[model samples]
Target: MTSPLSSSPAWKALLAHRDALAGATAADHWQASPERGAAFTFPCAGLVVDFSKQPVAPETLALLCALARERQVPESIEKLFTGEPVNVTEGRPALHMALRGDEHAKVDGVDIRVEIQREREHFRAFVEAVRDGRWKGATGKAISAVVAIGIGGSASGPQLVLRALAPDHEGPQVRFAANIDPAELDQALAGLDPATTLLVVVSKTFTTEETMANALAARAWLEAALGPAALAHHVVAATSRPDRAIAWGLPECNVFGFAEWIGGRFSLWSSAGMPIALGLGMAAFDHLLAGAHAADLEFRSTPLERNVPALMALIGLWNRDALGAPHHVMLPYAARLEGLVLYLQQLEMESNGKRVTTTGEPLDRPTVPAIWGAPGTTGQHSFHQWLHQGTEAFACDFIVVAKAMGSDPDRHARLLAHALAQSEAFMDGLDVPDAHKACPGGRATTTIVLPSLDAMHLGALIALYEHKVYAQACLWGINAFDQFGVELGKTLAGRILPAVRGENAALTPATHHLLGIIHKLAQSD
Candidate 1:
């Protein structure tokens, strides 16, 4: 069966162009054209993305943009901004863009701004009370720490942002627990004073197994330390199920509600960002939203060639499909952005890591590449050797801040040098006589340079990828918003839980035997 995407005129053009550029090195391309670097780089706000190191010519990019045109990407982006049901399978608009508070968007003829403004007021009042010591714990003491209980998007999104903006944080110390394993929660809550700790439980459904487990454990810990009545003073909920939150003994006033249309992975902009407002002030949070809004406007207005996110998406498609890259690495030089890859992994992989289209037809090409990486300088010691000399070729993105927040300009300069040197090294390798010292050149890398590691820049960086993922999904003819892929594992784990507990015998022998060994080990403990 012929796929619509592959059969498109633009796709045929790209395939022909790919064959025409076979065996051409990025270095060769650069040598042939003096203006390759300036010509390939694109800017959005203060962030500049240099995509020259990817194995793409001007014609390659033109053809990819043609593919986007054939796929009607601009129209899809319009649907995203206008709050149409872009997430067709789920029958929702995927309106996380509205949460950023710049668009005057209304879904289904209802003014969403009214509810958004109401929630913003609620967020500001609640955050100010907590951060200014006006909101006291049950013991009449001001809260000094916060424990965020969540899993997946609920846990990762706010936690990632909290870490990214750590240098700007002057409010309560923030902690996170996302695992069902008690050890993780124990470690996070180890030395905290329960009396002065506030728990923010974030689960859109109020029924995530790991999040609810951690939430219950947090409740028990707080009750054990501050009494059952203290729950009202210290616990708050960010969820769609406000009634369920209240039923769990949290006060109605402490329950924060966000719309169901806001998926967990894209939820940090919503009331799910309560912990963010508590850690960094609501003003800083507002700046973060404003920064993202700036990128949203750019994505809406900028042409595909000059659009940073669109260009990034086009380069990625070329690398994955045309260049046959199997893996992608995210190397961020800033220490504060340690969680950036974790956030992007979910954003990209969970959004596009599908084997089938929205209509359940099998895909002819790969979707999302396997994304993995760590913070650099640290990662350089661990994987740079393999990346430099390994047999496998992978596409990479190197993120660096142009300016450091603290003093010591020399250190920041060194970080910037490392980022540039790595990208350059990927293109220009040493040709040594000895095989051990020789390097294979022509790997692909995109360098993303942010003006600084401030919340605003970070917000723009994040929104850039959010739009890139959307663009890629549009090009691939798949829905970027739905994730039915994550449910089967959850369902299987639930089926296995009873067997592990020895409460039922309707289990596979292999699982039952494994449970016996686990149970036996537990008894010894």
Candidate 2:
């Protein structure tokens, strides 16, 4: 039960190099040093990670690789793919990947794959029925729009994929609402006929605060317009808690259950992906899985130095720890990938943003950077100025889909040009004599080029980021499988509800002070 960091020689070496590395500031020296680049570059999933710009040496990487090996990183990965209970705290296997393929792979002689495949098949049939106009509303109109209701992983993952693959899409107009704010639900439901709109409730537990609230609101809206029979046409629930969904009046046939093995953030391949499958189709969904499987195979079999996910993780570690960078930006050049940054934020930050290791030991260093970004061209107009001239140095990942799925060749060329220009500008920043205008020429960045914006490539890209998060967690000695950090605020909110309703006793002094301001504001309003 000892934390991986305790026994890692690489962690020790990294700690030892702290003083020397702090004194080093020249990016050129690191890049020119053959020894440095040789150790830094690693390939996996047919992608090359050039970490030569990073400050770590070859010996450091070898030691880190050794640390990973010693910690049974390979075994952990195999356990994940083969469906072992690697999510030890939850007593479940993390088998989101199995949702896309054969579930025959076993762990402890149990086959969870069959359950995942069954859900996928059910989703596929639903998608087909809707697309073919066989699934009609109470008014006998074909479904024309979809309102996906959920928060966090349920909303972010499918929303990202749908937006990214918009060009290849030929289906119903899809909208997602994740915020708990009443405005978000109101806006998503506005101007759409309740009868022709499909409301997909995507909470795994079927009882998420935001999702359930929105579901209730949606039900009120639909019943107001089309009556109780509208519920039969408008609702579909994605949850492990099928009984809860059924209790809420969703038909058992419309309730898709994914296994506990699929964490919310990684559940896109499971029934949580009903929105994605509905927006696209069975073929597209399958392609997305196939792409991820390709990346998975490559990540498992490749050498450490050539492993893409490994190299990405190590380079990220170097940036966060060695250079003391606090933020990591992901700028996808394609407009289609606008939501990708949000998706990655959850995938990377939620998974590894831990204060303690798996064994409950305090961490010696910061874990996980603040991940944020937007699509380029648009972001260039807004935030590129800060990125180039700001005091803070944030590492960036520039993602480019190699070929545009759009029909306009000219537009595609312009997109690619912007992507290349941004990376180049970041790496080779121009010098300005004006003190306020000067650019820091040594900003670090990594470029990820997907072959195309097809479902398969998008799937691969997502899986690549997923594996990178996992590997980094392994190296950092944290549990990538759990997210206990999100619970504190929720617990506090629940406790405050009765107080807000004035049903409880008078608040404590600190709480009274806040309530005084609230009462004053209510009078002013």
Candidate 3:
């Protein structure tokens, strides 16, 4: 039988190596290194990755790679390409790669090429119709605006892609509403005419509470404006359960479907990207897919010692498991990339934030760290102080773009400078005679340089992180695809909602007390 990950030889050797390197800092390696530490940077999928500031020695890397070999990271990657049901718990293959035109990708012994291509054509026809003014709203006017609705995976990925790729959107004006908050939908619908607006309701099951609530509200809003018959023309759906969507009032022509093998968080490349295609055009969307496919090739074929995502995953394991760091920060220099952090939070946390393994045994070591951060320069003002002097030990991933979204050379130059300066300050501290002025240095950071913020690069960046999440999950023996942990609260919320709506449902005393206060407050309204 295979040993537990904690008791494996490579893991034990690392534990010993951890004791061997005491009192050394990342700064120490920088000064004593050759080539001014330039060798630490690796060119990967069009980005330059520098791990010099991670505070790991050559021996540390060798041991970590050994651990990866023992964990069979390469084989895990192969299974993904070969369409194995790596997501064992769900009994499904997490083959989002098929969404990007992977010819060999499959599910249930059927190659997805023919099916995925057919779906792609259907997805394109709808998006092209809307973009080219061929599809009209209930009032027989070409759609000029869109309100995209869905929560979590259905929402975050496409929302971020459109924001990052199309800042000045020249196509149909697309606004996204993900939160169940009435204000979010209200804001998205504000000042837009129902006559010319289209709604893309994205949900895998077509019954997610938050998504359906928002979709129904938006449908009602449209019905009030254009009448009940108009919704057949006004609302479009991207879901696996087209029957539920059709039962809920969408026309059969308005429904687009993806396979059960696709997860929501990874669904942006699927029919979930309907909004992205409408907002950014099919050409841009295709470029995004191409970039991700390129990265997939790199991740699937590259050697373990130098693979980009593998290195990212291993270094992350070292930080969380060996150093005991509990959190990681992603600081993107471009503001449009702000959603990148939100997207990653769900990708890393929801995927690997588990207490149990794939077999349902307790996990012995830490997995993914709590992921959080804002866009840089802005983040510099918000959290730089704490990062520089805070008692907490955490890792930072900084994203630096060679050129920004704008054409102002001076502004981009200064933005790049600030990112570099902050990264340097993070790795090396200053000595001060004043006790209050001293800065704690030696914080580990990994800086990634994006060639530019185009669709291709953005796709590669997102896919790179996806593989990183998968690699870490493989190491932890966790089910990266299933999220049973999130289901209980949603189920309980379903039970609790009726009680809050004046029903005589039984409740805990504290909940009743809170509900009473809320009800009493409503009386004043």
What Cα-based lDDT does every candidate model obtain? 0.88, 0.80, 0.88
How high is the lDDT of residue 335 in model 3? 82
Model 3, TM vs. native: 0.97
Q: In candidate 2, how many Å is residue 389 off?
A: 3.1
Candidate 3: stretches off by over 4 Å? 1-3
Lowest summed lDDT window (length 10), candidate 2: 22-31
TM-score for candidate 2, please give it: 0.91
> Whole-model lDDT, candidate 3?
0.88
lDDT of 3 by residue, 1-525 (tens): 123678788899998898888846789877777554675677777878899888888788889999999988889899987888888888888889877756676577777899888889999988898889988887789999989999998888988898888664679888999999999999999999999999999999998989999998998899999999998889999998999999998889999999888899999999998888898899999999988988888898898778889999999999899988888999999988989999999999999998887888887887889999999899988888999989999998999899767978899999999999988888887779986888889889999988899898899899999999999998888889989888999987877898888887878888889989998999995
Instruction: Please write out the lDDT profile of model 2 over residues 104-220, one tens digit for every residue.
Output: 776568776665567767888899999889999989999989999999999999998888877656788888888989999889988998879999999988878989998899889
Mark the regions of model 1 whose C-alpha exceeds 4 Å error after superposition: 1-4
Per-candidate total of colliding backbone pairs: 0, 6, 0
What's the C-alpha lDDT at position 446 in model 3? 94
Candidate 1 colliding pairs: none
